[model samples]
Target: MIQRIQSLYLTLTGIIGIICGLITDFIPNERIDMILLLVVAILAFISIFCFKNRSAQKNINYLNIIINLLLIGFMVYYLLITPGGDLSPKKGVELIVPVLLIILLAMANKYINKDEKLIKSVDRFR
Candidate 1:
Protein backbone atom coordinates (compact mmCIF):
# COMPACT_ATOMS: atom_id res chain seq x y z
CA MET A 1 0.00 0.00 0.00
CA ILE A 2 2.75 2.41 0.93
CA GLN A 3 4.76 1.68 -2.16
CA ARG A 4 1.71 2.04 -4.34
CA ILE A 5 0.87 5.35 -2.74
CA GLN A 6 4.36 6.65 -3.30
CA SER A 7 4.46 5.59 -6.88
CA LEU A 8 1.06 7.08 -7.45
CA TYR A 9 2.16 10.32 -5.84
CA LEU A 10 5.25 10.56 -7.99
CA THR A 11 3.36 9.70 -11.14
CA LEU A 12 0.59 12.10 -10.38
CA THR A 13 3.03 14.89 -9.68
CA GLY A 14 4.88 14.31 -12.90
CA ILE A 15 1.65 14.40 -14.85
CA ILE A 16 0.51 17.55 -13.09
CA GLY A 17 3.83 19.25 -13.57
CA ILE A 18 3.76 18.55 -17.26
CA ILE A 19 0.24 19.84 -17.53
CA CYS A 20 1.26 22.92 -15.58
CA GLY A 21 4.11 23.53 -17.95
CA LEU A 22 1.79 23.38 -20.90
CA ILE A 23 -0.58 25.75 -19.20
CA THR A 24 2.19 28.16 -18.34
CA ASP A 25 3.25 28.15 -21.94
CA PHE A 26 0.06 30.05 -22.74
CA ILE A 27 0.68 32.83 -20.25
CA PRO A 28 2.69 35.81 -21.45
CA ASN A 29 6.20 35.69 -20.00
CA GLU A 30 7.39 39.04 -18.75
CA ARG A 31 9.76 38.35 -15.83
CA ILE A 32 11.00 34.83 -16.41
CA ASP A 33 8.64 33.01 -14.07
CA MET A 34 8.65 30.29 -16.67
CA ILE A 35 12.25 29.54 -15.77
CA LEU A 36 11.27 28.28 -12.35
CA LEU A 37 8.46 26.24 -13.86
CA LEU A 38 10.96 24.73 -16.23
CA VAL A 39 13.13 23.76 -13.31
CA VAL A 40 10.09 22.15 -11.73
CA ALA A 41 9.18 20.28 -14.89
CA ILE A 42 12.71 18.95 -15.19
CA LEU A 43 12.80 17.82 -11.61
CA ALA A 44 9.39 16.22 -11.95
CA PHE A 45 10.69 14.25 -14.90
CA ILE A 46 13.76 13.27 -12.89
CA SER A 47 11.49 12.00 -10.13
CA ILE A 48 9.97 9.58 -12.59
CA PHE A 49 13.39 8.53 -13.85
CA CYS A 50 14.48 7.64 -10.33
CA PHE A 51 12.19 4.61 -10.46
CA LYS A 52 14.81 2.73 -12.46
CA ASN A 53 17.27 2.90 -9.57
CA ARG A 54 15.15 2.13 -6.60
CA SER A 55 18.32 1.52 -4.64
CA ALA A 56 19.93 4.75 -5.74
CA GLN A 57 16.63 6.45 -5.23
CA LYS A 58 18.24 8.00 -2.20
CA ASN A 59 20.76 9.83 -4.32
CA ILE A 60 18.04 10.89 -6.72
CA ASN A 61 16.11 12.14 -3.74
CA TYR A 62 19.00 14.39 -2.84
CA LEU A 63 19.20 15.72 -6.36
CA ASN A 64 15.48 16.33 -6.48
CA ILE A 65 15.62 18.12 -3.16
CA ILE A 66 18.27 20.46 -4.47
CA ILE A 67 16.28 21.19 -7.59
CA ASN A 68 13.18 21.87 -5.53
CA LEU A 69 15.13 24.36 -3.41
CA LEU A 70 16.46 26.09 -6.47
CA LEU A 71 12.97 26.36 -7.88
CA ILE A 72 11.68 27.83 -4.65
CA GLY A 73 14.54 30.31 -4.49
CA PHE A 74 13.91 31.48 -8.00
CA MET A 75 10.21 31.83 -7.28
CA VAL A 76 10.99 33.86 -4.21
CA TYR A 77 13.33 36.09 -6.15
CA TYR A 78 10.61 36.69 -8.71
CA LEU A 79 8.10 37.49 -6.03
CA LEU A 80 10.17 39.76 -3.79
CA ILE A 81 13.00 41.27 -5.77
CA THR A 82 11.76 41.36 -9.33
CA PRO A 83 10.28 44.58 -10.66
CA GLY A 84 6.67 43.50 -11.11
CA GLY A 85 6.88 41.03 -8.28
CA ASP A 86 4.50 38.03 -8.18
CA LEU A 87 0.98 38.64 -9.35
CA SER A 88 -1.76 39.69 -7.01
CA PRO A 89 -1.98 37.23 -4.15
CA LYS A 90 -5.68 36.42 -4.50
CA LYS A 91 -5.66 36.36 -8.26
CA GLY A 92 -2.25 34.82 -8.88
CA VAL A 93 -2.72 31.45 -10.50
CA GLU A 94 0.72 31.15 -12.08
CA LEU A 95 2.32 30.48 -8.71
CA ILE A 96 0.19 27.42 -8.18
CA VAL A 97 1.92 25.07 -10.63
CA PRO A 98 5.53 25.51 -9.48
CA VAL A 99 4.63 25.56 -5.81
CA LEU A 100 2.60 22.39 -6.24
CA LEU A 101 5.53 20.79 -8.02
CA ILE A 102 7.87 21.70 -5.16
CA ILE A 103 5.62 20.17 -2.56
CA LEU A 104 5.08 17.09 -4.69
CA LEU A 105 8.83 16.62 -5.22
CA ALA A 106 9.59 16.87 -1.51
CA MET A 107 6.82 14.48 -0.57
CA ALA A 108 7.73 12.02 -3.28
CA ASN A 109 11.37 12.01 -2.20
CA LYS A 110 10.41 11.38 1.40
CA TYR A 111 8.21 8.52 0.36
CA ILE A 112 10.97 7.01 -1.75
CA ASN A 113 13.39 7.21 1.16
CA LYS A 114 10.93 5.46 3.42
CA ASP A 115 10.40 2.73 0.86
CA GLU A 116 14.15 2.22 0.48
CA LYS A 117 14.63 1.95 4.20
CA LEU A 118 11.87 -0.59 4.46
CA ILE A 119 13.36 -2.73 1.75
CA LYS A 120 16.80 -2.55 3.34
CA SER A 121 15.39 -3.60 6.69
CA VAL A 122 13.61 -6.50 5.09
CA ASP A 123 16.82 -7.59 3.39
CA ARG A 124 18.68 -7.45 6.70
CA PHE A 125 16.09 -9.72 8.25
CA ARG A 126 16.38 -12.21 5.44
Candidate 2:
Protein backbone atom coordinates (compact mmCIF):
# COMPACT_ATOMS: atom_id res chain seq x y z
CA MET A 1 0.00 0.00 0.00
CA ILE A 2 2.77 2.41 0.88
CA GLN A 3 4.65 1.45 -2.23
CA ARG A 4 1.64 2.14 -4.38
CA ILE A 5 1.11 5.49 -2.70
CA GLN A 6 4.72 6.46 -3.17
CA SER A 7 4.67 5.24 -6.74
CA LEU A 8 1.63 7.30 -7.51
CA TYR A 9 3.14 10.37 -5.88
CA LEU A 10 6.33 9.92 -7.84
CA THR A 11 4.42 9.43 -11.07
CA LEU A 12 2.55 12.68 -10.55
CA THR A 13 5.73 14.48 -9.58
CA GLY A 14 7.53 13.15 -12.65
CA ILE A 15 4.79 14.07 -15.05
CA ILE A 16 4.43 17.58 -13.66
CA GLY A 17 8.15 18.09 -13.60
CA ILE A 18 8.58 16.95 -17.16
CA ILE A 19 5.80 19.17 -18.31
CA CYS A 20 7.25 22.14 -16.46
CA GLY A 21 10.69 21.49 -17.86
CA LEU A 22 9.34 21.28 -21.38
CA ILE A 23 7.76 24.69 -20.97
CA THR A 24 10.80 26.31 -19.38
CA ASP A 25 11.40 28.37 -22.48
CA PHE A 26 8.00 29.93 -22.25
CA ILE A 27 8.37 30.61 -18.57
CA PRO A 28 11.78 32.17 -18.31
CA ASN A 29 11.00 33.44 -14.84
CA GLU A 30 10.35 29.92 -13.66
CA ARG A 31 13.78 28.49 -14.25
CA ILE A 32 14.33 27.59 -10.63
CA ASP A 33 10.87 26.15 -10.15
CA MET A 34 11.14 24.21 -13.38
CA ILE A 35 14.50 22.86 -12.33
CA LEU A 36 13.02 21.60 -9.06
CA LEU A 37 10.29 19.80 -10.95
CA LEU A 38 12.86 18.34 -13.29
CA VAL A 39 14.69 16.94 -10.30
CA VAL A 40 11.53 15.27 -8.98
CA ALA A 41 10.88 13.75 -12.39
CA ILE A 42 14.38 12.38 -12.52
CA LEU A 43 14.00 10.90 -9.06
CA ALA A 44 10.76 9.24 -10.02
CA PHE A 45 12.44 7.71 -13.05
CA ILE A 46 15.22 6.14 -10.99
CA SER A 47 12.77 4.85 -8.41
CA ILE A 48 11.43 2.37 -10.93
CA PHE A 49 14.27 -0.13 -10.36
CA CYS A 50 13.08 -1.57 -7.02
CA PHE A 51 13.66 -5.23 -6.03
CA LYS A 52 11.97 -7.49 -3.41
CA ASN A 53 14.13 -9.28 -0.11
CA ARG A 54 17.82 -9.84 0.79
CA SER A 55 19.92 -9.60 3.95
CA ALA A 56 23.04 -8.80 1.95
CA GLN A 57 21.45 -5.66 0.57
CA LYS A 58 22.86 -3.64 3.47
CA ASN A 59 26.11 -2.88 1.71
CA ILE A 60 24.23 -1.68 -1.34
CA ASN A 61 21.86 0.39 0.75
CA TYR A 62 24.73 1.83 2.72
CA LEU A 63 26.55 2.73 -0.45
CA ASN A 64 23.45 4.39 -1.78
CA ILE A 65 23.06 6.31 1.46
CA ILE A 66 26.58 7.63 1.18
CA ILE A 67 26.12 8.70 -2.40
CA ASN A 68 22.83 10.33 -1.55
CA LEU A 69 24.47 12.21 1.30
CA LEU A 70 27.31 13.40 -0.88
CA LEU A 71 24.89 14.54 -3.53
CA ILE A 72 22.89 16.44 -0.93
CA GLY A 73 26.02 18.04 0.44
CA PHE A 74 27.00 19.18 -2.98
CA MET A 75 23.54 20.48 -3.58
CA VAL A 76 23.65 22.48 -0.36
CA TYR A 77 27.01 23.94 -1.21
CA TYR A 78 25.99 24.78 -4.70
CA LEU A 79 22.71 26.31 -3.71
CA LEU A 80 23.87 28.23 -0.67
CA ILE A 81 27.39 29.36 -1.46
CA THR A 82 28.90 31.38 -4.27
CA PRO A 83 32.69 31.57 -4.62
CA GLY A 84 33.06 35.16 -5.80
CA GLY A 85 30.63 35.67 -8.58
CA ASP A 86 27.20 37.27 -8.43
CA LEU A 87 24.72 35.26 -6.39
CA SER A 88 22.02 35.03 -8.98
CA PRO A 89 19.76 32.61 -10.76
CA LYS A 90 22.39 32.08 -13.45
CA LYS A 91 24.89 30.83 -10.90
CA GLY A 92 22.47 28.26 -9.52
CA VAL A 93 21.58 27.09 -12.98
CA GLU A 94 24.46 24.65 -12.95
CA LEU A 95 22.99 22.92 -9.90
CA ILE A 96 19.74 22.01 -11.60
CA VAL A 97 20.82 18.74 -13.17
CA PRO A 98 22.94 17.73 -10.20
CA VAL A 99 20.07 18.24 -7.78
CA LEU A 100 17.86 16.27 -10.11
CA LEU A 101 20.48 13.54 -10.20
CA ILE A 102 20.58 13.37 -6.40
CA ILE A 103 16.83 13.07 -6.15
CA LEU A 104 17.05 10.35 -8.79
CA LEU A 105 19.56 8.49 -6.66
CA ALA A 106 17.27 8.67 -3.64
CA MET A 107 14.42 7.35 -5.69
CA ALA A 108 16.70 4.58 -6.92
CA ASN A 109 17.30 3.63 -3.31
CA LYS A 110 13.58 3.28 -2.84
CA TYR A 111 13.41 1.24 -6.01
CA ILE A 112 16.18 -1.07 -4.85
CA ASN A 113 14.10 -1.86 -1.81
CA LYS A 114 11.59 -3.61 -4.04
CA ASP A 115 13.87 -6.51 -4.89
CA GLU A 116 12.63 -9.57 -2.98
CA LYS A 117 16.12 -10.07 -1.69
CA LEU A 118 16.23 -6.51 -0.43
CA ILE A 119 12.81 -6.65 1.14
CA LYS A 120 14.35 -7.67 4.42
CA SER A 121 16.75 -4.75 4.03
CA VAL A 122 13.84 -2.36 4.31
CA ASP A 123 11.90 -1.74 7.50
CA ARG A 124 9.52 0.99 6.41
CA PHE A 125 7.96 1.98 3.06
CA ARG A 126 6.80 -1.60 2.73
Candidate 3:
Protein backbone atom coordinates (compact mmCIF):
# COMPACT_ATOMS: atom_id res chain seq x y z
CA MET A 1 0.00 0.00 0.00
CA ILE A 2 2.85 2.36 0.72
CA GLN A 3 3.94 2.04 -2.86
CA ARG A 4 0.68 3.47 -4.15
CA ILE A 5 0.35 7.22 -4.65
CA GLN A 6 -3.14 7.22 -3.19
CA SER A 7 -1.80 5.89 0.09
CA LEU A 8 0.65 8.76 0.36
CA TYR A 9 -2.05 11.29 -0.43
CA LEU A 10 -4.36 9.76 2.13
CA THR A 11 -1.63 9.80 4.75
CA LEU A 12 -0.92 13.45 4.09
CA THR A 13 -4.60 14.25 4.31
CA GLY A 14 -4.81 12.60 7.71
CA ILE A 15 -1.73 14.35 9.05
CA ILE A 16 -2.75 17.77 7.81
CA GLY A 17 -6.30 17.34 9.02
CA ILE A 18 -5.00 16.62 12.50
CA ILE A 19 -2.68 19.62 12.37
CA CYS A 20 -5.56 21.85 11.35
CA GLY A 21 -7.52 20.64 14.32
CA LEU A 22 -4.70 21.41 16.71
CA ILE A 23 -3.81 24.87 15.48
CA THR A 24 -7.01 26.43 14.18
CA ASP A 25 -8.99 28.29 16.79
CA PHE A 26 -12.13 28.94 14.81
CA ILE A 27 -14.22 29.52 17.89
CA PRO A 28 -13.75 30.00 21.58
CA ASN A 29 -14.86 27.22 23.92
CA GLU A 30 -16.21 25.25 20.98
CA ARG A 31 -14.33 22.48 19.19
CA ILE A 32 -16.92 21.12 16.80
CA ASP A 33 -14.75 21.89 13.79
CA MET A 34 -11.72 20.28 15.39
CA ILE A 35 -13.71 17.17 16.29
CA LEU A 36 -15.08 16.87 12.78
CA LEU A 37 -11.56 17.17 11.38
CA LEU A 38 -10.30 14.53 13.77
CA VAL A 39 -13.00 12.18 12.58
CA VAL A 40 -12.02 12.70 8.96
CA ALA A 41 -8.36 12.18 9.84
CA ILE A 42 -9.15 8.87 11.48
CA LEU A 43 -11.26 7.77 8.55
CA ALA A 44 -8.51 8.55 6.08
CA PHE A 45 -5.93 6.77 8.20
CA ILE A 46 -8.00 3.58 8.43
CA SER A 47 -8.85 3.58 4.74
CA ILE A 48 -5.16 3.48 3.85
CA PHE A 49 -4.83 -0.09 5.15
CA CYS A 50 -7.63 -1.43 2.96
CA PHE A 51 -5.57 -1.48 -0.22
CA LYS A 52 -7.29 -4.67 -1.45
CA ASN A 53 -10.72 -3.03 -1.17
CA ARG A 54 -10.83 -0.24 -3.67
CA SER A 55 -14.59 0.26 -3.46
CA ALA A 56 -14.55 0.68 0.29
CA GLN A 57 -11.63 3.09 0.12
CA LYS A 58 -13.44 5.08 -2.55
CA ASN A 59 -16.55 5.27 -0.39
CA ILE A 60 -14.50 6.40 2.60
CA ASN A 61 -12.80 9.07 0.51
CA TYR A 62 -16.22 10.25 -0.69
CA LEU A 63 -17.47 10.43 2.87
CA ASN A 64 -14.34 12.32 3.91
CA ILE A 65 -14.87 14.84 1.12
CA ILE A 66 -18.47 15.41 2.14
CA ILE A 67 -17.53 15.82 5.77
CA ASN A 68 -14.76 18.24 4.90
CA LEU A 69 -17.16 20.28 2.78
CA LEU A 70 -19.71 20.33 5.57
CA LEU A 71 -17.00 21.39 7.99
CA ILE A 72 -16.07 24.24 5.69
CA GLY A 73 -19.70 25.33 5.42
CA PHE A 74 -20.18 25.23 9.16
CA MET A 75 -17.01 27.23 9.77
CA VAL A 76 -18.02 29.86 7.25
CA TYR A 77 -21.46 30.13 8.78
CA TYR A 78 -20.00 30.46 12.24
CA LEU A 79 -17.52 33.09 11.14
CA LEU A 80 -20.23 35.10 9.41
CA ILE A 81 -22.78 35.06 12.20
CA THR A 82 -20.43 35.77 15.05
CA PRO A 83 -19.50 39.29 16.11
CA GLY A 84 -17.03 40.95 13.81
CA GLY A 85 -14.51 41.92 16.48
CA ASP A 86 -13.57 38.29 17.14
CA LEU A 87 -12.65 37.32 13.60
CA SER A 88 -9.91 38.33 11.22
CA PRO A 89 -8.34 37.46 7.88
CA LYS A 90 -5.83 35.19 9.52
CA LYS A 91 -8.59 33.18 11.16
CA GLY A 92 -10.39 32.82 7.85
CA VAL A 93 -7.27 31.19 6.44
CA GLU A 94 -8.06 28.12 8.47
CA LEU A 95 -10.64 27.26 5.83
CA ILE A 96 -7.79 26.55 3.49
CA VAL A 97 -6.96 23.40 5.42
CA PRO A 98 -10.24 21.75 4.45
CA VAL A 99 -9.89 22.93 0.90
CA LEU A 100 -6.43 21.38 0.64
CA LEU A 101 -7.70 18.13 2.16
CA ILE A 102 -10.51 18.06 -0.40
CA ILE A 103 -8.07 18.41 -3.24
CA LEU A 104 -5.82 15.70 -1.85
CA LEU A 105 -8.73 13.34 -1.31
CA ALA A 106 -9.95 13.94 -4.85
CA MET A 107 -6.50 13.16 -6.20
CA ALA A 108 -6.32 10.00 -4.13
CA ASN A 109 -9.72 8.96 -5.45
CA LYS A 110 -8.54 9.51 -8.98
CA TYR A 111 -5.60 7.18 -8.46
CA ILE A 112 -7.81 4.62 -6.73
CA ASN A 113 -10.23 4.67 -9.66
CA LYS A 114 -7.32 4.13 -12.04
CA ASP A 115 -6.23 1.11 -10.04
CA GLU A 116 -9.75 -0.29 -10.02
CA LYS A 117 -10.01 0.03 -13.78
CA LEU A 118 -6.63 -1.62 -14.24
CA ILE A 119 -7.70 -4.52 -12.03
CA LYS A 120 -10.94 -4.90 -13.94
CA SER A 121 -9.13 -4.89 -17.30
CA VAL A 122 -6.74 -7.56 -16.13
CA ASP A 123 -9.55 -9.73 -14.83
CA ARG A 124 -11.28 -9.57 -18.24
CA PHE A 125 -8.45 -11.62 -19.79
CA ARG A 126 -9.36 -14.68 -17.64
Candidate 4:
Protein backbone atom coordinates (compact mmCIF):
# COMPACT_ATOMS: atom_id res chain seq x y z
CA MET A 1 0.00 0.00 0.00
CA ILE A 2 2.88 2.34 0.76
CA GLN A 3 4.02 1.83 -2.82
CA ARG A 4 1.02 3.76 -4.07
CA ILE A 5 1.21 7.55 -4.34
CA GLN A 6 -2.27 7.88 -2.83
CA SER A 7 -1.08 6.08 0.28
CA LEU A 8 1.70 8.58 0.73
CA TYR A 9 -0.72 11.47 0.20
CA LEU A 10 -3.12 10.00 2.74
CA THR A 11 -0.32 9.55 5.24
CA LEU A 12 0.69 13.16 4.85
CA THR A 13 -2.88 14.33 5.20
CA GLY A 14 -3.29 12.35 8.41
CA ILE A 15 -0.07 13.69 9.88
CA ILE A 16 -0.91 17.27 9.00
CA GLY A 17 -4.37 16.92 10.47
CA ILE A 18 -2.97 15.64 13.74
CA ILE A 19 -0.41 18.40 13.90
CA CYS A 20 -3.04 21.04 13.24
CA GLY A 21 -5.22 19.68 15.99
CA LEU A 22 -2.39 19.71 18.48
CA ILE A 23 -1.06 23.17 17.72
CA THR A 24 -4.19 25.10 16.88
CA ASP A 25 -5.22 27.56 19.60
CA PHE A 26 -6.24 30.68 17.76
CA ILE A 27 -9.91 30.01 17.93
CA PRO A 28 -12.21 30.27 20.92
CA ASN A 29 -13.52 26.87 22.09
CA GLU A 30 -10.75 25.12 20.22
CA ARG A 31 -11.87 21.72 21.49
CA ILE A 32 -14.42 21.45 18.71
CA ASP A 33 -11.86 22.25 16.04
CA MET A 34 -9.40 19.83 17.52
CA ILE A 35 -11.96 17.05 17.60
CA LEU A 36 -12.91 17.61 13.97
CA LEU A 37 -9.29 17.59 12.87
CA LEU A 38 -8.68 14.37 14.73
CA VAL A 39 -11.69 12.84 13.05
CA VAL A 40 -10.35 13.81 9.64
CA ALA A 41 -6.98 12.32 10.54
CA ILE A 42 -8.57 9.08 11.61
CA LEU A 43 -10.54 8.91 8.37
CA ALA A 44 -7.43 9.45 6.30
CA PHE A 45 -5.57 6.75 8.17
CA ILE A 46 -8.47 4.35 7.71
CA SER A 47 -8.61 5.11 4.00
CA ILE A 48 -4.93 4.30 3.67
CA PHE A 49 -5.50 0.69 4.67
CA CYS A 50 -8.45 0.33 2.29
CA PHE A 51 -6.19 0.40 -0.75
CA LYS A 52 -7.63 -2.86 -2.06
CA ASN A 53 -11.10 -1.30 -2.11
CA ARG A 54 -10.78 1.71 -4.34
CA SER A 55 -14.44 2.67 -4.09
CA ALA A 56 -14.34 2.62 -0.31
CA GLN A 57 -11.12 4.61 -0.28
CA LYS A 58 -12.60 7.18 -2.63
CA ASN A 59 -15.73 7.47 -0.54
CA ILE A 60 -13.69 8.04 2.60
CA ASN A 61 -11.72 10.75 0.83
CA TYR A 62 -14.95 12.39 -0.23
CA LEU A 63 -16.14 12.40 3.38
CA ASN A 64 -12.84 13.85 4.55
CA ILE A 65 -13.04 16.56 1.90
CA ILE A 66 -16.52 17.55 3.01
CA ILE A 67 -15.41 17.71 6.63
CA ASN A 68 -12.44 19.84 5.71
CA LEU A 69 -14.68 22.21 3.77
CA LEU A 70 -16.84 22.61 6.85
CA LEU A 71 -13.73 23.23 8.91
CA ILE A 72 -12.64 25.95 6.50
CA GLY A 73 -16.04 27.56 6.75
CA PHE A 74 -15.92 27.52 10.56
CA MET A 75 -12.46 29.05 10.58
CA VAL A 76 -13.57 31.80 8.24
CA TYR A 77 -16.58 32.52 10.43
CA TYR A 78 -14.35 32.73 13.47
CA LEU A 79 -11.87 35.00 11.74
CA LEU A 80 -14.59 37.38 10.70
CA ILE A 81 -16.08 37.54 14.16
CA THR A 82 -12.77 38.08 15.89
CA PRO A 83 -12.61 41.43 17.65
CA GLY A 84 -9.14 42.39 16.52
CA GLY A 85 -8.91 44.71 13.56
CA ASP A 86 -5.83 42.81 12.32
CA LEU A 87 -5.59 39.07 11.93
CA SER A 88 -3.05 37.19 13.94
CA PRO A 89 -0.48 34.92 12.30
CA LYS A 90 -1.92 31.92 14.14
CA LYS A 91 -5.37 32.58 12.67
CA GLY A 92 -3.89 32.50 9.20
CA VAL A 93 -2.12 29.25 9.98
CA GLU A 94 -5.30 27.71 11.34
CA LEU A 95 -7.23 28.54 8.17
CA ILE A 96 -4.49 27.27 5.88
CA VAL A 97 -4.37 23.79 7.44
CA PRO A 98 -7.93 22.86 6.38
CA VAL A 99 -7.29 24.10 2.85
CA LEU A 100 -4.16 22.00 2.71
CA LEU A 101 -6.10 19.00 3.98
CA ILE A 102 -8.65 19.46 1.17
CA ILE A 103 -5.89 19.64 -1.46
CA LEU A 104 -4.17 16.50 -0.20
CA LEU A 105 -7.48 14.63 -0.04
CA ALA A 106 -8.30 15.68 -3.61
CA MET A 107 -4.90 14.52 -4.86
CA ALA A 108 -5.37 11.16 -3.17
CA ASN A 109 -8.79 10.80 -4.77
CA LYS A 110 -7.32 11.60 -8.19
CA TYR A 111 -4.69 8.92 -7.85
CA ILE A 112 -7.25 6.43 -6.54
CA ASN A 113 -9.41 7.05 -9.63
CA LYS A 114 -6.39 6.56 -11.84
CA ASP A 115 -5.63 3.23 -10.19
CA GLU A 116 -9.26 2.10 -10.58
CA LYS A 117 -9.13 2.90 -14.28
CA LEU A 118 -5.90 1.00 -14.67
CA ILE A 119 -7.41 -2.04 -12.97
CA LYS A 120 -10.48 -1.86 -15.19
CA SER A 121 -8.33 -1.70 -18.29
CA VAL A 122 -6.29 -4.72 -17.15
CA ASP A 123 -9.46 -6.68 -16.40
CA ARG A 124 -10.68 -6.02 -19.97
CA PHE A 125 -7.79 -8.13 -21.32
CA ARG A 126 -8.89 -11.22 -19.38
TM-score of every model? 0.63, 0.34, 0.89, 0.91
Question: How many angstroms is residue 124 displaced in model 2 relative to the true structure, after the best TM-score fit?
Answer: 14
Candidate with more favorable, higher TM-score: 3 or 4? 4
Model 4 has how many clashing residue pairs? 0
Candidate 4 clashing pairs, residues 3+ apart or interchain? none
TM-score winner between candidates 1 and 2: 1
| Winner on lDDT (1 vs 4) | 4
Candidate 1: tens digits of C-alpha lDDT, residues 1-126: 324555666666667655654665433443354554555556555656567576565565556556656655656555565455365443334556556665766677677778778888999998
Which residue pairs collide in model 1, if any? none
Q: What lDDT does candidate 4 reach at residue 61?
A: 97
lDDT of 4 by residue, 66-96 (tens): 9998888787887778766455554556677
Q: Encode model 3's per-residue lDDT on 1-126: one tens digit a residue.
A: 668999999999999978877765543224788888899899999889988899999999999999999888988887677665643544476678889999999999999999999999999999
Q: lDDT (0-100) at residue 24 of candidate 1? A: 56
Give the lDDT of residue 5 in candidate 3.
98
Candidate 4: deviation at residue 89, Å?
4.3
lDDT of 2 at 19: 76
Off by over 4 Å in 2: 1-3, 25-36, 51-126
